[model samples]
Target: MALSPEDVIKKSFSATHLRRGYDETQVDDFLDEVVVELRRLVSENDGLRTDLEDCRASRGVASGQGAAAPAAQGERHEDAEDTQELEALRRQLAECQEARAAAERRAEEAQERVGAAERERDEARSSLEAASAGAAVGASAAGGDGEDPSSIISLAQRLHDQHVAEGESTRARLIEEGDTYRTTVVAEADERSAELQRTGQETHDRLVAEGQATHDELVQTGQSRHDELVQTGQSRHDELVSTGEQTRDRLVAEGQASHDQMISEAEQQRSTVLEDLHGQESALSATIGGLQSQERDLRERLRAFLSDQMERLDGSRPTS
Candidate 1:
């Protein structure tokens, strides 16, 4: 496996059987370099990620408003964006799941390492116990050989000190390893979460701005179109009304002329009929007067003739 800064910093060596472990100055110098490199890499990666996210956000916004779009087209664009967002969410979720899985694997590996370390510690403890028992037995044997009691006690003390020092070193190493792994895991997770949050926020802001821009554009276009339609309709209505007025005026004038002609013709016919009646009445009256006069003259003649006939009869016949 690749060694990270934490691993390098936390690396430990077993207590030497004959000499001290690794040189502390050399180890510290190497760890410092590793830590600086790790920091530089992390900073560079974070910067690159931020730049990439910003570029993507900018491109998405530019593409969204690159052309004049209708409302339906804009809705389709929104749906497409929603779909893309859902896909991105799914991808992010998958990445999170993968990261979680990786963390779990790391946790398992860490557990294994801890178990191994614990086992090693237990073995070390057992070895120390065994060594103490051996030293006691040796001291007892030395005492049986008539050795000095002070020397035996001093050997036992030396053995105890060595075992204690070894145990302390092993414990410290284990603690440092655990802390390093924990810090690395937690730092990585926090960094990833922060990056995701920042990217999501940027994307959201860009999308909102683009949507607002599109909405304003559509509203303006619709307003202008409505005004144009209204103007056109008003114009058409005015033209129709003017045409209707002209037709009405023409029909009214024609009707008036026809009415006047009919009235004049009727007046002329009435005058002619009245004059004919008057002339007929006058002729009848004249004929009636003449007939009356003739009747009177005939009556007078008849009376005279009757009288003459009577005289003649008187003359011709005997008087009666």
Candidate 2:
């Protein structure tokens, strides 16, 4: 029976598995290559079929013309050429069919090989399992050879105890390391806090001193200017008392406007400083949260490692 393209591809994949010992990836690659070749063959076959059809149509046209003109030399020559071309196409088609058949046969053989290999692999696995079970039974029988089972059990218990003790030691060591890390973190946190506090205190003291100096300078300037103005105005006070009152009113108005401007500027500066401080605090909080998360992850990893070690130790422990 002729195999379909899909069957051929499947057989090819199976063969690859048989030859290469059940490599899925290799089988897939082989199938892909087979598909590419199959597609090429299909295209060629279609082209050949089309060529054959054209040849047959030409032969039919020649035969009709030959029937119309029984002795026409030109018609006879044309008939001969058409016959030759048709023969050539038939031959080519036959070759393509033979090639396809051979490919299918090879694919089938590969599939059989793969099936055989799989069966052998399964048999080997079964043999191994049986052997292992037999060994366990033999070991059990040997244990029942008039020997004191309790003595054997006791020795096993001692070995298991020793293993457990070793694990405990390891766990104790890890705990110590964890404790050391915790202590280090605490110390760093304390140091950072102290540094921040000291820096804040120094900044506050410097700002206070600067403010006091500025205030003193302002007060002295105001007092000196007031005295000068009074001394200068005393002589002219009698002549220009109303003028002096008008000027004083203007100065008071200007000072009030300046004071209001200064107050608004100070309020804006304070708001900006508060926003900056808030941003810094938020950043620090995020940093602390990240550190805490990292610490938690580290602890989890350490625990997982310890658990894995414990499991290994338990598996290796002697059974009572």
Candidate 3:
């Protein structure tokens, strides 16, 4: 099916998970290229169609004059040449259409892969969150289960440590995955960009060469038309090159920004998690310290009371 620019612009991908998948920005940039290529194809096809119609009309005119003119042989040869040129244009148009369709298919496949990765990441996050929540609730409930404060505190501390460890591991894994994926993507983009530039240069050279040859051959017959074709081909080549360069730069900038943003967010989240863990640890330490202080005071009071009771008993024994 044919894809439109709006479909690309409106497509959304989940952002919270940075698993091993196509970068969202890269995919969007690729879709943007596809859209540009599609537009170019359409425009070129329209021009070719118009040129074809003109050629047919010109041929009709030449045929009308053929009946009254003595240059029938020359006109017939010209008509055959026009037919060949028209066929070539038609073939080029067909190829452009086919390329457009292929590009659309690729874009769709990329979107699908990205969507699947996002769904998988979502599921993993949900499971981890649920597990952490359940563990927290269990730890809170254990304090009311007739367990001593020390045991409860120990259990809570272990759970906290476990959670912290898991968080660190997950964070590390995600960062590594992101780095690997980003590296791979950037490399591929660079390589692809270079290849495209080379291909564009080659195509431009070939087209210019062909235009020069045609201009030489038809200089006497249609010099103005030949010049126009050359100018148009040169302009088209320049536009394609400029567009490719602009796209490459934009994709590079976006990829860097995305990488930086991901790193910054991960750091912020890590900091927040560490801060909460530290606060919890500090609170538990204070509670334990307070309990110990109370126990020491009770011991001192019991010792003093026993000593006073012993002295009173001695006095009441009549100095024995």
Among all candidates shown, the one with the greatest lDDT: 1
Q: Kindly give the number of clashing pairs for every candidate.
A: 0, 0, 0
lDDT of each: 0.68, 0.59, 0.63
Model 1, residue pairs in steric clash: none
lDDT of 2 by residue, 93-115 (tens): 45555654554565455555545
Clashing pairs in 2: none
Model 1 scores worst on lDDT over the 10 consecutive residues at: 55-64
- Comparing 1 and 3 on lDDT, the stronger one: 1
TM-score of each: 0.36, 0.26, 0.28
Ten consecutive residues with minimal summed lDDT in candidate 2? 12-21
How high a TM-score does candidate 2 get? 0.26
CA RMSD of each candidate after superposition? 45.9, 57.9, 47.7
lDDT of 1 by residue, 271-310 (tens): 8878998999999999999999999999999999999999
Best-fitting candidate, scored by TM-score: 1
